[model samples]
Target: MPPIPTPLTLTQLLNPPSRDGLLTQIVSMLSGLGFSATDWETDSDGRIILQVEAQTLADLWQAVYKIAQGGYLDTATGDWLTLLAQSQYQLTRNPPTQTIGEFRLTAAGGVGPYTFNKGDLVVTYFDPTQNNKALIYRSTNAAPVVVNPGTTRSIQVTADSPGSAYNIAPGSVLVLNTPRPGLTVDNQGTLQPAVATGAILNGPFFTAGQTLIVTSALNGGAAVGPTTFTFTADYPDMTSVANALNVLIAASPQAGRITANVLNGALSLSTILITGATAVDQITIANTGTANISVGFDTGSATSVSGAYSWISEYGQDNESDTSLITRCINKWATIGTGTKAAFISWATSADPDVQKVAVYSNLFNGTPKAGAVTLYIAGIGAFDIVSGPVHANNVYAYIFPKLPIMTELFVAPAARNTKDVVFTAKIKTQYNNDTTKNAVFNAVQNLFFRLTIGETLYKDQVIAAIITIPGIVDATLSAPGIVSDIVPAINELITLGSVTPNWLVVV
Candidate 1:
């Protein structure tokens, strides 16, 4: 039998040199240039790797790296040195994104014509001292707004901060204010339907000399004086009378910020910027009509007030980060080819910009199907886009589901390990702690098991080993059913942990 030939080191490669290939020659050249080289896992391409030593690692790596990069060595030879410096130079690229946040404004004063000037809104929160994070929004083209009176509008604003997008805590108060030159109000007056057919006062019969006084209050502005509109003719149709009153409000200088239209044979009034919470109060509708004229939707025959105003809070997110973008770029590169289930799963779980958790199964779990059918269950913040179209790039028999059923089961506490003693700090002594070590363990284990493609073993000892790292955890054990030595799942099934009780985190 022929004896195995010995491998050449950096020293041997440069000496009395026999024909030993380009790798040796490359190392010999690097040696002359005051750089050390070592053979680290040879490939079809002869790439000479630098040894991991303090002096040569930094100074020599830098000097020899310049030599390789001086265009002396081939491209393949430089790649090995490049890999060695991976820790120094990150390959991640920044992504182009805008930080998007929103404020939900709900208008009151029933069936309104709420006008929100695009540039009128100013929102401030999340460490107000850091004023750079404040978000301001307004109408783009016009001073007033185009909006449905009786609805909620979500105003999206682009915000910026020193670093990444600001993650505002949920339920944080979104203090909203406006400084536009207009009175904001929640004062509203709705028209009652017609009861009869007539040219004036059509809905209800109004005798001659009848009167309705319209009054409004402004937000941080002057009080709008009441305007009186009287019927000139006797027993006129509701339309003519309502029209006359609308004309009266529209023409009056005091009613400059108010408008009235005859809706369903009754007068419907809308105040400009006045809101209920700001000021806009004392909205009285007086009926000075003779012979008891009927007012529609008015609690009584004389006066009525507007409803109270309210608002809801919502959160916004900042733009993508450099790290997240690099992860996405790599994932996109990974999924560019034939869209196999594995490729799709990789994109969904790790690559797709939005997806965070995913599980892919070949066999049927939700419903029965052919042997080759594939199903994917995924979840994340706005991760529905991945499944909006096709599940796989090329496969036609794949189905995507929104949420997979969470498998819930209790695991008994591990048996007391009397042989060994473990010690942890007081923080992890509680069943559940703010430190989140337990949650981290649960998530890590879940990631290993709850995946699209299954056939992985869940070892009880592995979980126990993870939990033991928490502070104040003296000891831990794994009992049967909940967790044993190991449990192998079927190709179609995925395991999810529902909860872990305090009894399970035992100490001997």
Candidate 2:
């Protein structure tokens, strides 16, 4: 090489340089110096205004070289100029270094006996991560003084006390010294007394129906009466008094009458009576006939005073009556008697004259009948059977009136027949009967018996849906509807089968 040309000084290269070209040339130089350039902005006259980083200066220089080789020397020169100016500006504007200090008080030294007044702030250096050094300083101190490094020292400084006095230095923290004694219940399972002077009771106690007495002494030296205080009973296990009472009511009756035992401070029942034919747990009765019979219940023996009593007059009579043909005829028509027998009798008498006999026989097929009769009447016609002795062992000796003619008069014709009407009516009647019978049976099984009606007319077409006689089973499914059917069958089945044992079955 003949001679090496000296590189231009930064100032010399840029002496009176064009502000427009300066940024570009500086950026190109920076790219060569290993700084990245991302973006560049220029003034309207092409002076570089801003430059950003996107790649390392070495990479940028390589890119610029490629561009220069591609005949983009102007772009390359502009980039170099921008980078040089930015580097020189940064060097001229370096930031000052920050100063910090660290100090610690001897462990023996704490917030002082020496007080600091208001408007005085003590300067302290502390590692935020470590405990602070306790320092004492005055508001009037002329200059900052370094505290003895390792020893505990009290530096006297005068300071005015602030209204809300607190001792805190610039880096010295404060810890609370106020007492924080926890409160707690002293007595549990009992009521707490009223808080009095100097009383320090705090609570978490179990108090149920506990009475507390509070007494106060008057300023005049007179003693006040003790004021009674009570804590409400909290029965988490049982809901309410009424609810508990209901539960008690629902529980099986204790073997005693419900008697208010004044002596025991409680309500209870008398001892169960265990004696006699009438020995019963309970009893119920319903009188359907015109005659009213008195029921004498001896709570002592749990027995009925009346022996062999009839629940329904018609049923009782029909049950005892002779089963003779003439007696049957009379029963089938005699005022439609009282219970189911009466019901059957009305049904038989209501049929057409030609159909009456057949209806009577059909009604009696599965029914109980009277014993006997000497004279039989058919459609108001009498037919006397001359018997030397009693016609039947349990025969009726007197006259047996025939059933009245079925609608001899037009005005007495039965209501118009509607299949729907019949079905609905029959269903309703049957349901009523069954319900009544069930109620009665339930009562009887519970040693409580009662009687209900089977209505004036029997639903001849109604079929028996079921006959449940399960022992100890109170609920029974009945084909019929209301009270009558329920009571009669349940009672009779219970009595006859001796299987069903429940004294009562409450229907829903």
Q: Which candidate is the best by TM-score?
A: 1
265-343 per-residue lDDT for model 1 (tens digits): 4344445554333332334344433322332222123333321121111112234443443344344444445234455
Best by lDDT: 1
Q: What tens digits encode model 2's per-residue C-alpha lDDT throughout 1-508? A: 0111266343332233333344456666666778664343434222232222212333444554544433321222333433322342211111122111112223123322332232233432222212322222223334443333233322223222221011121112322121112211100011111110100112222334543332232211233323333434433321232233233333424212211111111111112233222211221111221101101111111111111111110110111111222233334444544334343343333332211221122111012121221111111101101110112101211111233333211001111001000011111223334333433233232121112111112222221222233222333432222222322221111111111222233333
Our model 1 lands, by Cα RMSD against the true structure, at 23.5
Prediction 2 TM-score vs. true: 0.12
Go through the candidates in order and give each one's C-alpha lDDT: 0.37, 0.23
Please give the RMSD to the true structure for each candidate, in Å: 23.5, 47.7
